[model samples]
Target: MKSTYQTKDFWAGCVYVAIGLAAILIAQDYKMGTAARMGAGYFPRVLSGLLMLIGLASILRAFLQPGERVERIQLRPMLLIVGSTLIFAASVRYLGTVIAVPLMGLLAASASRMFRITVPALVGLALLTAFCTIVFQMGLGVPLPILGSLFGG
Candidate 1:
């Protein structure tokens, strides 16, 4: 019925604080130019500060307010998300964006129970993919690895 936040969340918050603080300090070692372009360190420093604030908030909320007991722990959805991400990362180099993109899409879609991948869905996916390839590759001339030509290139 009642529970504090997960111990993992507390530790994760602490870790974020440490990382943000470390990043801010480390960026000072880099060469940042004057105010016009913003020094190399400026953006990172700002981001780290933001992260630090979030981490502090996370820590405070965990301590003060707490969270409800997870009455239902749905492992399948979590597994699907994590597994698909791993598959996407591992497959990207071998398959390239053309194939990998669809696989990633399918896997992400598969993550939800109600979303069954149908023939129409597959067709739509392929068509949209072709549109993307044309827009980004042919029209815009941005470089993305197509499925073929890897044997030669």
Candidate 2:
């Protein structure tokens, strides 16, 4: 006997396929270019095509697997990810990189299994923040506002 059809996963796959197709169309309009030189839309167009392929595979998985457990999308993890993003967005502009990075780390850490994060993890997160800041601000020469010059800028 066939297992229960996963309606949510099926619909999500359909939506992904539709979105991928739309992206391809839009990227085409933006003039994705030749083999030697890529236009603004080239990578997006290629990525979207791959996405469409993956969506089809997912749709097949949802139906063809015998006695497959219905995949339940957990709300908690979703909420955690979404909440962290929101917090980062809200704080980034006002707080700036110096303060924002640590705050972002703290808020993001709350999303994990442990409400209180270990010092090592916190340190790791801080390093990630510093790496991102340096790469964007110094290496790429993009201006990221640092709230206070804690590291002497």
For each candidate, the alpha-carbon lDDT, in order, equals 0.75, 0.74
Candidate 2, superposed: residue stretches over 4 Å from native: 1-69, 148-153
lDDT of 2 by residue, 79-144 (tens): 767777787677666667767777766766676786777788878887987887789877897666
lDDT of 1 at 33: 71
Give me the overall lDDT of model 1. Answer: 0.75
Candidate 2 residue 14 Cα shift, in angstroms, is 7.5
**Every model's TM-score:** 0.54, 0.49
Instruction: Give lDDT tens digits, candidate 1, residues 1-153.
Output: 134555445656788899999998999887667668887787898899999988888777777766543356688888887888888678665676688678877877777878977899999879867876788878897665666345332
Worst 10 residues of 1 by lDDT: 1-10
Q: Which ten residues in a row have the lowest lDDT in candidate 2?
A: 1-10
| Candidate 1 Cα outliers beyond 4 Å, as residue runs | 5-16, 20-97, 148-153
* RMSD in order of candidates: 5.6, 6.9
